[model samples]
Target: MSDIIRRDPRAEWIARNRLHPLHAAMQPVQHSWMGPNGVIRKNVHGVGFIGPNGIKRIDRSGAQQGGAAKRTAAVEVQLPLHQVAAPAFYINVVPDMVGGRLSSHDRDLLGLARQLAGSDGAVLAVVFGEHKENAFATAGVDRLLVLDGHEFDGYSPEQRVQGLRAVDNQFNPRHWLLPDSRSGGGELGRRFAASLKERPATRVWQIKGDECIGRAGAGQEDLARPLPRLILAAVECADPVSETRHEVLPLELSTALARSLPRIEDLGAVAVDPAAIPMAEAEFIFSGGNGVKDWALFHQTAASLGATEGASRVAVDDGFMARDRQVGASGTWVTARVYVAVGISGAIQHLQGIGACDKVVAINLDPGCDMIKRADLSVIGESAAILQALIVAVEAYRNGAKRDAA
Candidate 1:
């Protein structure tokens, strides 16, 4: 018994006492090993794995310790209020494409204005058509300046720029926020910025406190600064719970301002493509790439899904799709809710265009493609086969929904 228990004296003594039947019967069954310090030692170590000893201590130099303390102190310091600039006036040029009613994109612009106004400034919206005062009031705007009349119904780049210039002269706004949507807002903003001799930042996406951050020019670098002399923003979504709200003061359009506008010949309404939907307005987009073999089936799938058709640059260059349908860095940038890339290898330029998309679905032959890696859901198979199955599934679901509704 002594040879079996060479280490612990308590274990040897216990074994010696256990020789008697009474002592062995009286002893309680013990499985745990406790230290002499009246505590159970845990197997914890600095390297994450348990070693022979308990824990290993890592030593840090005095300089490293002091640096960490300094970083913590720096974070606790309060930022100066003067760092943020509060503009005297914020002018929002409402696009003419939405007519009298405010779209989701328009509401987003109003939300941004409310955010920028804070407590010191006023947000003035320049609307193109006649709308109910209550409609504009609920948008959290300080004032609504209407540009009514038949002449303002259609969008003309030259005329719209003149109208914006007239508004700028009247108000003398230090900051201008225009929608960068395809609804002629982008064109109007560029022309207006040129007329004012100010470089406008287009497709602005994020607003951090008082600093506006967005992509500048063709490069990918994100630029940040306080509201410049002119700013062109693209509205991604509407915020329902905005803090700023004010009674909207409706202002009548000046007769002189309207009459002073140049008269351009109305080139009667041009034919619109019935099959195509504008990329900016599309909530769902089905984009095809070079891997797509069946263009006819692609259009059918888009129609079934109630999605707008878009194409990669390669597809456009190959004459498989039209120029206007191209979606990339050089082409149109789309901010759709759901973008389905069928047979499209995600080029960097194509990825840039759809950066604002909420969800992306990629169907491709190669599992390691960039589109597959970036997509929220990836279907690995032939494009035509996958799309056909998806179309059938969608049609069946719609039929079932209709029957249930009935």
Candidate 2:
């Protein structure tokens, strides 16, 4: 009887444990377009199978649509602990065009949100507007909560605050972020924080876990340690203040404070490293703006003075120069020793970025332009003519200095 038909438990287990492959043998593939032979070519897009017989033709109806890469799974990223539980951030949507499309601050805010939202943590963005879509919808946000209300379209700060508050209540987001600008944003943030008693970090460059870090600090040394989440409603600075008022301080005032107060170790506020702040040690700066009609002459003047060229957002947006070199709400903040504003209108957005300069010279034909009021020295003349003349004067001054040294 075949050795009494002894059964091996191990062999039985192996046969029982054999796994059926958990996937379809032949996934549907599709045709795709490829560029070849200097022309778009159509070809089979993915891998498939031939029958076991290897000769019989079958229907190609199983192929899925939309090229070759079949959608298999949802994409997701694990965020830090605080980000997971922290209140989602609501980016109060700014208009794409303001002041007749002359202002680019809205676009700048959108860009800043894209940069800040993901860098610090996985904070979701809640966009509010008539369109009510993420200005950064392309950033692969997990969830975009669009709150569309007519009040937002009307530009009512109170309405905006109320709408935002309602959304916040529903979501119970723990943190709020906004840009530092004169466009009622500061007031809105302040009011919202007051109403909800939740922490608001305005003009926030970076958000760390649940803690928001900034240059703004309460003056008391001990108070500086805990670092309260407050409105950084102005550009960032690393200086001590005689008085810490929540009110926004002009860039010049903050710089003066820095000079007056001695730097203390572990002051809590992020200090402005001179190296990081542009043009802080510059002897001369040639600034240009939309008023400077001739790009070639602007370049020539900068070259003549051996000065770095600065352009306002107007010039940059109009395709006259790159954004990095642009000076305005969306551009680099600077504290140059000497600043020359050529044809710039000195809008509040522009002023916020360069108000720390020691000396400002304005060159423009429009005496009424706001830049004239802000400049320590105002020259009322055409930019081209004034720039050409100034370039010669600077060159002569340099040559005279060399001769005197000799």
Candidate 3:
């Protein structure tokens, strides 16, 4: 054997091609090993063994891979803690928290509140009722206040205003920030402002120094005015807090809330069909494309997931779905919180349609598909199998939730 090193270009090419039959064999066996810091590292994919039929079988735990140092059991990220022992002032934020989780709009509002809070001031998030959110610290909330009561549940804006009033009397926040959207925030902010007899800056997109900029008169003009005590901020007002984590100290109102006589009667939620919800307004959209072989299964999956049905241009052109269900640059532009693409190749137009979506999930057999590139989560598998698994998972989740509630 010569001491000189010789590189094989063909072997290198084969190793680079993950889809190639000889790709895994040509690659170096890197399973698990201890890092420089003595932390165990594992290659999760390297743990799988060849089955009797030559099919690769992956162990969900990846214990075998842990021995190869390919995957870390848990990647713990420790962000700098922003502590406010005593606050000079307070910037109160009311998040929509749709689906019991922090929406992008809510995070943006909190970001704006953090800007106002500064170093001395603290960002206090006021959540109504019970929420499933557990990331208040990461969302830039220095304090967390939950107003949970049967009286404050449902469509009791008046009671909510009273609660806010009690909060106002206790903390007297320097500024109040709320999301200026249709999902309960805009209405609540306006009502709260009325109760306080203070004019709120509505539709605010930018806030600087002593000036706030917002949209006015059907969004045809820019309205710049002096910063008010209450602000109803629009989406993307500021980038969400990503650098540091806050203390998220729990706080309670020292004073009792004054119960208001309800002029509005409490009416329970009305059931509506997911299909009736427009793609633009739908929070979750399940979209299919030309690669979808079982259209019936696609529809069933969407129905099971409780997501609005949408289709790529190819699927629409093929007459597998309604023209109104098409989602692309040519169709309706969606702003869904979660957009699931099934068997979609991700055309430029299709990608453009879902550009405003917060999270994109791609399900396709082809690992190199364009949709996979744009997706936040990608599962390379048969669409049918994935959809079926999703259905089963959703059912299990619902059952578990019911059991917990019971």
Best by lDDT: 3
Give the distance in Å from residue 344's predicted Cα in candidate 3 to where it truly belongs: 2.4
- Worst lDDT run of 10 residues, candidate 1, spans 75-84
Error of 2 at 403 (Å): 2.5
Error of 3 at 133 (Å): 1.1
Ranking by lDDT: 3, 1, 2
TM-score of each: 0.46, 0.34, 0.75
Q: Give the per-residue Cα lDDT of candidate 2 at 196.
A: 68
Q: Residue pairs in steric clash, candidate 1?
A: none
Q: State the lDDT of candidate 1 residue by residue for 239-276, as single tens digits.
A: 42132245566665454555545566667768544355
lDDT of 2 by residue, 44-104 (tens): 1223433212433332333244321232242332322212234245333332222222122
Q: Comparing 1 and 3 by lDDT, which wins?
A: 3
Show where candidate 3 strays beyond 4 Å.
1-77, 322-324, 328-331, 347-352, 367-380, 388-406
Q: What is the Cα-based lDDT of residue 94 in candidate 1?
A: 61
Residue lDDT tens for model 3, 90-170: 999999888778987898798889888888999999999999888898889999999988887788889888888899889
